[model samples]
Target: MRAQRVEDTPGGRLPAVADPLRPFESRSAGVATTERVLFGRLTTEDPVQAVVRRIRTAIGLGILTDGQKLPKEADLARQLGVTAFSLREALSALRDAGLIVTRVGKNGGSYVQRPPASDSIAEEQLTGLTATELRDLGDWRAVLVTYAAWLAAQRASAASSDRLASYAEELADADTAAAARRALGRFHVELAAAAQSMRLTRAELALHEEFDWLVQVLLRDETHRRAIVRTMLEVSATVRAGDAAAAWVAGEQLTAYLVTELTRSRLRLIAAGSAGPGPKRRRAGDIVAELRRISKQTVGILEDIADDVAAGVTMPPTSGELNGVVARSVLPRLGRVEDLVHGVGFMAEVGLLPEAEYWMEWWQRASDGTFDRDYSHQLDPSLDDFYEYGSQDYLTRPRATGRPNAMGPYIDHGGVDDYLVTVSLPVAREGTFLGVICIDIRVAGLERALSPWLARADGTCLVLNAESRVLLSNAVRYNVGDVLPQSSDLSLTDVGWFGWVVARAPEEP
Candidate 1:
């Protein structure tokens, strides 16, 4: 089923998906994420094998968690875009592997049966990797973790900063590897959240997914584990102190130390000559999952923007500037829009959105029906451009229909001077349409957030817009905006209307 225009929010994985209870600190909103991630469309892999891998990835990553019952056979097949027969073959394969149990009749369905320990065969896992690959992954982790901590120090609230410190303590007290891994990964995830950029948060989750299991081999040792927790706490302290430079150094040091430990583990494996392939490169499923995460956080921010507008700028909204709300000489209600502009663009203070000053804009209809436009960005629009609001689909579509509209990957050439996608939803109270809340995400940021995951795919892949235009691609043959060729050689997999990926079909096994 399609999401209603006003209700077009994608099912997301971020904790900030508007939960009143345990918001920002809990796991996802629950099963919708499972549906989004595990039951998403299959890429170009053998369909049966693809289905098996999706379930295994979800269970292994704890997305499905221990003992969680999978949906019914028919339901699972429907979600996966496979037939019932193919679904059964996949489930039977899982049963044979002892990953799931099925007891039918009454009160019965397939239930996950995860092993108590993860695959700690680091020797085998690292044997196939070269020095360059190891160093590259480590460098990526360092850059991602360091910037996350630095930005968190600069932007995190007092409560959240203290929570990071407290979370570090939780890692110190973690008794088991499973508990420790969760704490370790959550520490970075929490740090990303504190930074308040959805793109950063999505990127952190992507980084964690690819290596969380690999890190457990090191965590199995008590000495290495304690060392990790100790350094994490120290970095958390810098973040709590709001010292960005200190946080940067501490976070990098922590990640670098872990990289050293992993390298040593790999070196020992190589010296022993215990050769085996490492885990599979991440797949297109992971890309879909990352997009869902970004979608969820974007929705969270969009909701905040909508709520701010719906709540009214002031008691009467006609009252003169109050609460530091700046009134525009052109219109006072734009002060509300101005407040919204600041509200949405705060996510870019640390460089997620470079020209973030113009990232948010509100276009509203007044009582007399003329449109009033305000930007959160400090720069004023040219008089002619400000007056020529008719061309903005971000405003016109939503204002006319009082619904949602997503526009662009188009260049904001005359405006922000960047490639941007503007996602907007109508601001309404009761039956009235007031305005549209427009949030412009940098296409470059989207590319950076997704590039890490797409690069992990073993083969070439490209994410396409609903119209089959490329939005992101790992293949040089297909750049963003290129129309993907219609060919029997290409396999296009749709993960709902939000996006799709095109890849080459696997050869028969």
Candidate 2:
């Protein structure tokens, strides 16, 4: 334990410490600083992809303007908490994509390249798309934009509202097609931003990037351009007024207009044979109509069940008495229910009914003698949470508002463990809410019913719930419960399953 002599370096002298704790403290401090910095930048996986996404998002959002020089590679790498090699790889990908260019020697660095003209870029991106694919892309954009507008109306701040209005005004005043298209795109991005959801904003940026060319094409027509600007202004005004429903409708109208234009353009291209001999498109119209018919019928059945329960049960039974009553009364009615009805039950308000007393059809055979016994009730924590009064259970809203409602893309009741949609009707008598009558619709069965229709569709088809979680898919790429990635080319048709249905095709060829 001798004290070490201080050593002189280029600019400073460092005293050699004999105390082991001093060196440990200094090392720990260095580690702590490094960890903090890394925590800010490091993603859980795929640093290169993350870096690329960040830069691309910045560019797409106009945060990084054209010809803006990026920081030196080393500095950027350090900031992103990635290896220099990874940064170089990401930069290389960007360069390949024509988003950036690298220069060598003095004053040399990576600079963003100006984007290609919108029409040329759009033509290139859309070169291979068939009419069906273009229509589907339009539909998907419609859903996303409409939903974003609705949410923004509900939650946007005053500043966000003002910004949206300003963007709309700018779009209206834009004299040139290019200027109008740019403004229109910015208006959408700002609208999504007003929703106060980062995911939505990112999605908007991505969608705009994907369809910039299409917007350019549409904007070139003076009539179409003016109409779109007017639509944007109307949507902005609705959002500013905080009319969520109106905003949603406005957004949908705008989407419909755009989709119509796109469709006409696609048809023209097809007639010109520029789109090539398109794939044989199968119309899902009949199948969709059939599905809607079945869904409505099922909902009607559930409503009748609720009405029967409300009329029969004069007084709310205690938790201990509910199961026995349901067994004797409700279970027999459920027995006669359709085979597609996986399970039917009554859920009492929490604390009013014991968890075990929630009546569910557990019989293997219904009263109609069908082999329908594949259901169970386990005390799943998630299911228990769902049964609570304020939960997203179909019954919750119905019970609260005295209106029927549907909720889904959720797992089975009581954690029985199957993806299903629940349609519930409020059981009320004389203005008193008793409980909820719920019917579980087997998503698998519905998919089976639609199998013929899905088979007819030109490409793969997915039925996605409100959360965009797949309830069923004929595509090998997706499975039940898989969340669909946001893409422009996915065609979405709203079917009657808890605001879910028919997402088809993919962006890739």
Candidate 3:
């Protein structure tokens, strides 16, 4: 039957077609014109599996080429008559298959993947098996593989036998752990295929993932892996020579060797642990010190920017300044200076005025404690809580409260040029507020300035005002203008990534 679109009508009823392909044809009294496709002929009744199959088939057929995208999840759900949850499941399965991948950003979305077939075995190994798990896998593999080889000797055709033999002969050239594993896995898969039983073939193919995992964990190096590959190859060759019993004996030998090696490897790891002050420990300490240095430097640069702003005396009003909320004259002097205005814009966009106020205070302190705080929510436009939240204690402290640390926003809104630098003047003179000022440094600039520090550290930085509007960010994936919600009251920290900071220290500045 031909496929047809089900159209919805103005009355919210499904329209019945007399003859969809040839419209205007009338139906007879006794005619059965309901030409719906049968369930068995259609895809899986399980919506998730159906969607997964569609995506896989689309990729396989080149209908969904690499770098191509699919419809958004909600739209897909509506088209497929499935829930968003089902669509997510289908996407997860496709991701696991290495046919699709995801990225997060303003421009980001799911994409078709074209991973090399060469990496499939490695991916399976990395995702599936651990060291201890591999030892157990080795035991099962020894038993089943030996049986399969013995059966192959009794049953293989001439062509299949030759294929198996050819794979075995290639093992001598495998000089690396990865190469040996691949060559050996191919040999086993071929041996199973030689059995001429679909059940056995599928069982082996199905077990390939487990096999890859075991090889990854148990086989530690070229020497250890090469030994296993050599033994397995020999077993298959011996079987092909019409000695089934010899293959079984070879399997037992391999299993014994693995058990002994696994025991020794565990003991060595244990001994290494008991002996303290290893290279990894030193590396970890170095990483921590480097991170601390980066934080201090970032803070320093931010303070310096503030001081610079503070040192430059604001030009005295030659004439009374125009009274207006939208003052175009206050625009930044540098493209980077536009960043501070952008920061305010982002805060306003996210309805985080209180947080914005806090940012202003931090900027002032970093700059040497003298800058104006524009409190009217109307001017800021991003602040949401003008009536509820007040600025009574705002900028009144003589010394730093040490309460609202600039650290959190610095971490949150962090990016390249972000730093804490400050400038100062000897005396409070003339119209100068305090001869000191601060600002949240730009992310891009901070990153470039601290390239040395960043190369050694892997951390995040962000900036938000008192109203919780994200003004700037060093988190690579976070998009500007995302109105991030405040931390949940019930939870100690937020549930989102990096939300832990909010929960871990509710009283954090």
> Using lDDT as the measure, which candidate wins?
2
10 residues in a row with least lDDT, candidate 3:
30-39
Candidate 3 per-residue lDDT over residues 222-309, each given as its tens digit: 5776676667666666666777787677756765565445433433333343345434443344322433444454334434443344
Q: Cα lDDT for residue 366, model 1? A: 40
Candidate 2 C-alpha lDDT tens digits along 282-382:
22246557667677777776677676666666455555555555555555576456556766676665444445434333344345646354445443445
Instruction: Using TM-score as the measure, name the better of candidate 1 and candidate 3.
Output: 1
lDDT of 1 at 270: 45
Candidate RMSDs in order: 24.4, 18.3, 20.6
User: Per-residue error at 35 for model 3, in Å?
Assistant: 35
> What's the distance in Å from true for residue 164, model 1?
3.6
TM of each candidate vs. truth: 0.42, 0.44, 0.33
Model 1, 203-314: lDDT tens digits are 6656664555567768778898878877888887888889999999999888877876675565455434312332334233477766665666555556665665556454
